[model samples]
Target: MNISTIGIIGAGNLGTKIGLQAAISGYQVNMYDVNDKILARSLKSMEKLLVHLTRTQQLTGDEGKQSLERIFFTEYLNLALQDVDLISESVIEDLEIKTKVWQEIGEIAPAHTIFTTNTSYLLPSQFAEISGRPEKFCAFHFHDVFYSKVVDIMPHPGTSSEVITILEKLGRKLKQVPILVKKEHSGYIFNTLLIAWIDAAGRLVTGEIAEVEAIDKSWMINFGMTAGPFGILDNVGLDTAWHITSTKRNPASRAFAALLKSYLDQGKLGVKSGEGFYTYPKPSYKDPDFLK
Candidate 1:
């Protein structure tokens, strides 16, 4: 299918990035959220991102303006789905919430519109039947679109070959390297590796093995990495890490989830909330002397 118009279901962080990238790629985008405030925030985020992209010379001033013009924000689901060639759901990672959102989209979205989920760890098969179009459904997971350019194309047993082909082409058009996950593995590839690394960091903190900064410095100095697990978790949103970590039954994961929950309760959701493992806009890791 020639995807021209894309509907983004969820105007949160990742969803907003996806919609903006689609618009920049010359695809008309409809970004949807249940709350008006969230929709408004998403637009502001896009505007800020455009400024950065323009200043960095990644996009021309006129191109950034055109990209914003191509995006339409709406709170109404049906309106967003109207005439859209594809729907990418980036709703909360909860199965129940995602299932409910997919069910609604399945009912209202055009029959020809392809359904894709931006779920991080969840499998596409979990919602395929609920969407009422198993063959047309797949997981089109993305990392940080601008920085981390890989897009994972994961399809369930029922997904069609044609859908996979279309997504591969679409991923490239969006300027993302496409990776195929042959089976339904939770957390896909990078994330699976990330979880283990994060679990270790969390253990060090929760177990009082080391301070957050020490752990981060250890990884950064040795690996030449800019950020460590805790720093990365901050960018991922402490609440999101809690959600994913809470699902694990292991003792270490449970303890880590509890630590994350404490941060969430304090309203520290990482970069978006202005604080997490460290304060942002000028996080400690960014300090020139951090490693020293």
Candidate 2:
């Protein structure tokens, strides 16, 4: 199905990026979150980003303004899901919460509407077992920067070819490159490979192979600024990196878990709580403070 009005369940970074990009692409976007405050904050953040894009010549004056007007933010789930042609779930990473939300979404959304999850670990089929529309469900993983033009489209055993085809088309419309995964699996393609590197990095950090600065600088020198792992982790939030790496550790997540515990104990959680592997000068999205 051609997705015109898209509903996004979470208004976090990924959700906000997708929603903003969808809006810019001339698709009506409705973003929903449990907290009204977050929804309001997300709207403000979207406007700020659009303004920045306009200044950078990345977006035309009319396009930026139109994109801002295309997004509808709300805390009401039913209203957001109603009449939406496609819904992308970007809520918390927990399966139980996702299942609960999808079950509710299944009951509200039209049967023909496509349901997609932005989960990195959970497969689309698992949600189908509990959610309402299995055949129409699939995985649409967006990178940290949705506008980067790269997306992973994963279809499970229950997903129909029709759904996959439609999602690929939708990805193109949003200016994203769609890479399909034939089967469902934890971490799909990108994250699985990324997690391996992340695991090795965590070990290096804990084992004192190199300080965080050296590890981060090495990647910057090789892959350029945005490609560094430690820098990326700092921007993504240490808590999030910890959550992703929690599944792998020297002692089955023990080493990483202990590191996370100690970091939290010291009250450093990266950009969010102010300090992490490195301290932040301000809460802005500048590169992670390398030395503190």
The estimated TM-scores of all candidates read 0.88, 0.86
Worst 10 residues of 2 by lDDT: 283-292
Which residue pairs in model 2 clash with each other? 270-275
Residue 160 displacement (Å), model 1: 1.0
Model 2 lDDT vs. the true structure? 0.81
| Number of colliding residue pairs in model 1 | 0
- Candidate 1 stretches with Cα past 4 Å from truth are 206-211, 261-284
RMSD value for candidate 2: 3.5
Residue-level lDDT tens digits of model 1 in 99-201: 9999999999999999999998789999999999999999999998998999999999999999999999999999999999988899999999998899999
Instruction: Please list all clashing residue pairs in model 1, or write none if there are none.
Output: none
TM-score of model 1 vs. true structure: 0.88
lDDT of 2 by residue, 4-50 (tens): 89999999878998899899989999999998989888888888888
Task: Kindly provide the TM-score of model 2 when superposed on the true structure, using C-alpha atoms.
Answer: 0.86
Q: Score residue 148 of candidate 1 by CA lDDT.
A: 92
